[model samples]
Target: MELLVIVGVFFLLCAVFFIRTVSKKKAVDKAVDVDKDDSYAFEAIGALFTAAERSFYGVLTQSLKDNYVLLGKVRVADIIKPQGNLNRSEWQTAFNQISRKHIDFVICDKDNLSILCAIELNDSSHNKADRAQRDAFLSRALSSANIPFVEFTAKRSYVIRDIQNELHQFLAQQSSQTPSADTKICPCCSSQLVERVSKRGKNQGNTFWGCSAYPKCRYVEES
Candidate 1:
């Protein structure tokens, strides 16, 4: 009877030890997971803009003065959402394309911060196949949005007046296109028509009328 009792106690102790071993393993794993959950360790980037971008920013500050708001590295998705007509899956697909893309610089209305234009500081890389394709996509997207897009080739030195002239030219165009009582309603979306300027290729700097709802309606009338 004593021998049987000893064997039973021995088995009981073995099970207890196995349970303790598993508990220790789980505790250690939990500790490791807690250590991994740390959210810190982020470091500051020395400056917001690269040397080239900084140089241009200076000129923009000078050119825009206090008349407009300038925001850098603005996300395209923030400026325009997928049109309401899109089905959920279609919206998700469209949103995914631009959720991470950014415009190099964005000029916005001072009062409301409405995007007046998006600018790209183009270097020679823009001429390459990949960059060109990406630029084309952005161009198409922004055009569909009816927001003005401007491009300036990167240069070792920039002329402030030149920048002012081009930007003001666009602003002037916008001023001219400002809606009046005579402006017609968009037949597609029922939004009023807005004036727009072409920003690319041979037709660049040309003016046209586009639906105010823009990317959503994409209705156009020749100016």
Candidate 2:
């Protein structure tokens, strides 16, 4: 009888402990339910580009119209990757270097959207030691990837023709480096095909690939 009584008391104590433990857990969970009804607040930005950037963007659009696809604030990691046979840690280290950085503008081939070159609108901010260091690293990285990089000063006014001419030079660079038989070349004079805007023709405003030799070669290809 005594053993039975002790056993019953033990069982009763066990049941109470279990109930108390479950209640305490529930109380703790309820107290810590921070996500229940609270909402995170956010606001939309006024604009993505600053005054200088906006001005430059306008110039780029005017100059590049159907010539190239300009993607702004492109993350560097999206364009280039760590090359060849790296261990996990090395790959991660390389990725981390570029993941946080972005190019102000990336020019892509309009047809296939292949990255062509990267451009930066450097204002006074880029003159700092830190900024200069960042610029050098990015220059090296982009060059290593065979992606040409250019910088234009943040000026109150930019010449449209200058931008067009510089961009044309970079676009022609890939084919000019070491022209393979398959590379696009001016068939007439066997010279590098250069991007040119029609100055006086029915397609005056249109851009096209013409021979760098121009008057002498007179070879033109539709771009």
Candidate 3:
């Protein structure tokens, strides 16, 4: 009976030791997990702060529009129109010539009959010799096309207000120089028709020119 009692005492002691060791291990693991979570939280907060700083400066410096903010206001169709980026390829094909380079912004009046001005924003990276050569080539092309162009730098902190003022001034000057209307001759029937809007699709209320001959002369020009 004494031997059995001794065996029971030994087993109880072993269990107590095992429980204490497991508890200690669990406490250490919990502390490590807490530290890891804290570190990740700090990193996420730091990234958020950095992104906020960039966005604030972009708004102040007008770089947002120069980069991609203008896309929000302008439709993709407008951007790809013949007066804008699409003019590059159209002009090349029309003249049977290819340009060595291309211009960035092509601002025009409401009618889009003539290009009023072009604006190019350059960054510090574009200050390199190669980029300067490209700019020079694009400038020559603009000159050949009888278009005026301006270059600005974002690194110099050109603000949004500054760009707005410049654009307003240029538009005012262009309006004074351009004629009120262009000579329009109908392509289908050679008739003198007035500009009108299409009464179809989402553009039902939008401006477009149509033939006065109605069903007989089906002609349209977008305004």
Candidate 4:
């Protein structure tokens, strides 16, 4: 009887250890899955920002050529999408004196070697008082420096084409006082037929003169 009782106790201890080990393994698996899902979500957001930047550049390029504004000499920076508040802290502090959502773009005027503008694109999720306050601060900063600061909020779902049109109108208004004689040359090929903004890619919003002899004498420079 004593031996039998000892054997039963040993079996009970083994079962308890087995259950605990299984539970721990399941928890680890769950954590890994959550991390993977978060990574995927982040990648998706990055792709969206890239697309928006490209669309904005395309519109600006077309508008400049069609409207004969600034002789297509304006320069736009690449779209800068910060990952989190930490990444955007410095810019936020400069504009709003606080760290919040990331900035979208830092635009410049290559003609006079001055910063022309800064743009922020907000989605439905950004409709909070904090965001408004930040925008107000940015507006004040830009206004004081005689620079243009613009904001665009999605009416419903974010549409790339609509945003592009809005950007074109804003650029036209801003460059109204610019002179046509201020034609910019493409730095790469020294071509005078250069148009502002990059021809392709995520840096599409960047203002640079590209050669009309693209693909052959491809050259570009920030206006």
RMSD of 2: 12.4
The C-alpha lDDT values of all candidates are 0.80, 0.79, 0.51, 0.50
lDDT of 4: 0.50
User: Distance (Å) between predicted and true CA of 174, model 2?
Assistant: 9.4
Clashes of 3: 2
Query: Per-prediction RMSD in angstroms?
Result: 7.9, 12.4, 18.4, 13.7
Each prediction's TM-score versus the true structure: 0.65, 0.64, 0.34, 0.34
Winner of 1 and 2 under lDDT? 1
Off by over 4 Å in 3: 1-100, 173-223
Candidate 2, 1-223: lDDT as tens digits: 9999999999999999999999999998987785574675769887888889999999999987564678898899988888778999998998899999999998876545667679999999999999999999998888666566899999989899999898876666333255667666877767677675554448876888866543345677788
User: Worst 10-residue stretch by lDDT in candidate 2?
Assistant: 169-178
- Residue lDDT tens for model 1, 86-113: 9999999999999999999998755445
Which pairs, if any, clash in model 1? 144-215
Off by over 4 Å in 1: 1-36, 173-223
Candidate 3 local lDDT, 1-223, one digit each (tens): 9999999999999999999999999999999888778555433444422333344345434632332222111221232222345567685563342222344455554332234446665667678999898678556555444345567665533467766666553344232232346645568865444454333457866766654333246577876
Model 4 TM-score relative to the real fold: 0.34
Sorted on TM-score, highest at the top, how do the candidates line up?
1, 2, 4, 3
The sequence of per-residue lDDT tens digits that candidate 4 reaches over residues 1-223 is: 9999999999999999999999999999999888878555433444534555555545544444343322221222122222244546665544344234344654433333223446666665557888778678666544443345667654334455555565553344223243357655446644344445542467756775544433245465556
In candidate 4, where is summed lDDT lowest over 10 consecutive residues? 70-79
The deviation in Å at residue 29 for candidate 1 is 11
